[model samples]
Target: MSNASRFKFFKSHHVPTLTVLKAAIGDFSYAPHAHEEYAFGVTLAGRQDFFSGGQFHRSPPGNVILFNPEEVHDGHSGGERALDYLMVYAHPEQVKPLFADVLGHERGADFRSRQTLIQDAPLRQAILELTRLVTSQAGSCIDQENALYRVVERTAQLGGHVQPSQVTHRPEALLDLAREYIHAHLEADMSLDDISQAAHLSKYHFLRLFRQHFGMTPHQYVMNGRVNAARAALDQGTPLTEVALRFGFADLSHFNRRFKRIYGMTPHQYQRDIAR
Candidate 1:
């Protein structure tokens, strides 16, 4: 049989400090790499084996894995069948406070174990729920936020950590300025430099802070805004091509792909559903 694979990234409005990944792979293997943020995931089907810390880990269906910031790891399918899973990469600053709240202490901490893997079914289910909320655009922001908190709390309880103090959040005004620039230029081809300038910060620093506060990168935020604008124009019965051009999309096909990625439906389908 031919190998089939898929990977998707989802941005959460409520949990702006986390980005979700959904993947199914048959033959792909990940090279050893380290993330600057916390990586947590649960295997849903087949099996996945990975190398981390000083040893290897085998994660079967329903097993959860957690990697602290800068933890080195590599992943591959354990069998012929594809492995399906959902992963959430979270900013440590965002997770640490929640960890403190779960432990009812002010000390900062990381996961207790470098080789963190759990077989708890209930926590696995909770992770799945949080993944669904973050990936689904239908949920209210309040609901998504509450679910995210609960999932983090559960994860912290499972793998204990102890640090000294909480992480400080970036100033709100800078983030606001960056967002204001994005909204004002939704129909223009905006660049990272432009957005960073609006925030009066370096591009790299601005990119990190933007993702922490928005749950997505600056480019993603701009694309989302453009798609939202396109949706509004379509809802008014505008032609697809016109809508695409008006929203700064290169063409109708590009607009359709982005819209489908975010909303899980093409523009025509969306219009039909709204009409009904």
Candidate 2:
């Protein structure tokens, strides 16, 4: 919310698979966080600094930054000047279909980007054009999809992936039950004990294991589920007030703030955009 930072997010009905972020930051700093999607960033002006893959990086103009899914990192401006950049986020569920032709599903899903920082003219161009298409919202569906694929392919070419090794983690049934409980009781005032009890685990154990497995807390998961359900209802022309109440938001203002945080727009703004 600082004056030194700004973020504009754009997602199109034509290309729902990718979300574009246009950002300019000077004094603000990002807390360490990771995304569930692949993110590619291009620096347009000034300098940007971030840490990822256990390395510190400074990206100047014309540089591209790549972050794989669940890659923990933080970012901010590198100097006195603001950092102008564009980032494209591609979800795995959407991107997996695109990789079938280029790298096959098995290899592509396993693929990880190794270059956290680099200067690649082709990749940078694709990303810039992608930001243009998504933000402008003035291109054909085919055009947008083509641009997305071009970026994905160029990114895949910068590969640092091998056959992913086997891994073991928590049992899915407990988490599945927990998620079911959250969705089933969206309108209820659920607490940590409520959810963890539904999962049949101790509160602290469930909290730790859930975050480790899902990258988000139990409350965050519930909020996300509620927002997503609200989105669906809005698409059905449900009244804003009804949608908020149905989703268990504290009030219209609370709904507005939380929805904006999740979808990058208030409910009213989102409705208007979808209408357009």
lDDT leader = 2
- Cα error, residue 168 of model 1, in Å, equals 21
Compute the lDDT of residue 43 as modeled in candidate 2. 90
Clashes of 1: 2
Clashing pairs in 2: none
- In model 1, which runs have C-alpha deviations exceeding 4 angstroms? 109-115, 164-276
- Each prediction's TM-score versus the true structure: 0.57, 0.71
lDDT of each: 0.73, 0.77
Off by over 4 Å in 2: 1-5, 26-37, 49-58, 67-78, 110-118, 160-168, 171-189, 197-200, 213-216, 224-243, 259-276
How close to the true structure is residue 134 of candidate 1, measured as C-alpha lDDT?
Answer: 75
lDDT at residue 187 of model 1 (Cα atoms): 84
